[model samples]
Target: MHPRAGQTKKRTRIQAKNEAKILEAALDIFATFGFRGTTIDQIAQKAEMSKPNLLYYFRRKEDIYISVLERTLDEWLTPLTELDPDGDPIEEIGKYTSLKLKMSQNDPTASRLFANEILHGAPMIEHVLKGSLKNLVDEKAAVIHHWVKAGKLTKVDPYHLIFMIWATTQHYADFKIQMRAILGDDVDQPDYYEKAGQTISTVFFEGIKPR
Candidate 1:
């Protein structure tokens, strides 16, 4: 989905690697400086490539920015997409919660990048938010509804439940500085996220488990 079109041929290993490198550098730049503050030259420098070489893969800064956001969105949604309706509702939700927290712990940059995009009105990725994201969330919400009706969960708004999970899990990434300030550097430790997942699951399941 990167490299200016027109080739109509499969990318070589080198081409694929170069594109990945560009996206990786662009993510760091965009996440730190944001879209407006970031520039093609900055990404090229970050990638340790000449500007011309970088442009060979991505013609415009906007192209690189959109690609990064698209990739991040796919990754950010993967945990929810994995939720299985056929599984035990509480267990499934707990697994989803843990996976989401793991993502924040492992790749907080991606989470912050995405959160910043939304804060600015998601000007670049609104279509995706409306289409693919909406469809996926709706499908999962229906699954949650099914669980509730089947007496697996207490009556609750599926959309809000999903939103609550997102808010709570993502807080570790979006407000990491605040977290680190209050909780200290231990916030970066694996056990911290594990404990967070356990605490969140306990609180959520306690409220939602069929009473």
Candidate 2:
């Protein structure tokens, strides 16, 4: 179902605001309940709006779910999109790693939601995964390869390196419960993210620096 705003009419400020609210509420609901288990009413309640009013923006639960996923993907990929080909390879990669880890630390629900979608085969976003996501990763992978060819980094499979960075950074979010359990209260310390970022950067840089 197309969102009501997509009907060739420019959305008013109020309409836009309501749509944002609905999506934010829907994200929380879908993340907790899974897509199949979430309902339009649940989203409406979360958004603190009437069901009919919420329906004015999103026609179905699936539409809202897809919108939430798309928004998450856009935010999730913004750091990668900013990767500068002309920048120093180690610094650029380190910055990207820190940004990703910060996202995981600050918004673990978004990470777990995305991870769950992928684990279920990404039925709702398979095309996006195959098309835009694959294309973006390919573009960044080339940047990594260029750095290596310029003797800026050690030899490594660019694709696998990208995958490795994603896995290592997102683990903090996707397995927060397990991590907190094992690490005790240290994970809750004020400087935990700072330390994690420094440790990740050090490990990645040490392994990839030309040897």
Q: Pick the candidate with the highest lDDT.
A: 1
Instruction: Kindly report which residue stretches of model 1 are placed more than 4 angstroms away from their true locations once superposed.
Output: 1-7, 207-211
lDDT of 2 by residue, 1-211 (tens): 3346467877788888899999888888887778887888888998999999898787777888888998898898899999999999988988899889989888887988888888888899999989999999999999999999999999999999999999999998888778789988888775887888877887887754666
Instruction: Give, for candidate 2, the lowest lDDT window spanning 10 residues.
Output: 1-10
- Look at candidate 2 and tell me the lDDT of residue 40: 85
Considering only N, C-alpha and C atoms within 3 Å, which residue pairs clash in candidate 2? none
Q: Each candidate: RMSD to true structure?
A: 2.8, 3.0
Error of 1 at 94 (Å): 0.6
**Estimated TM-score for each candidate:** 0.91, 0.88
Candidate 1 residue 140 Cα shift, in angstroms, is 0.8
List per-prediction Cα lDDT, in the order shown: 0.89, 0.87
115-147 per-residue lDDT for model 1 (tens digits) = 888888999989989999999999999999999
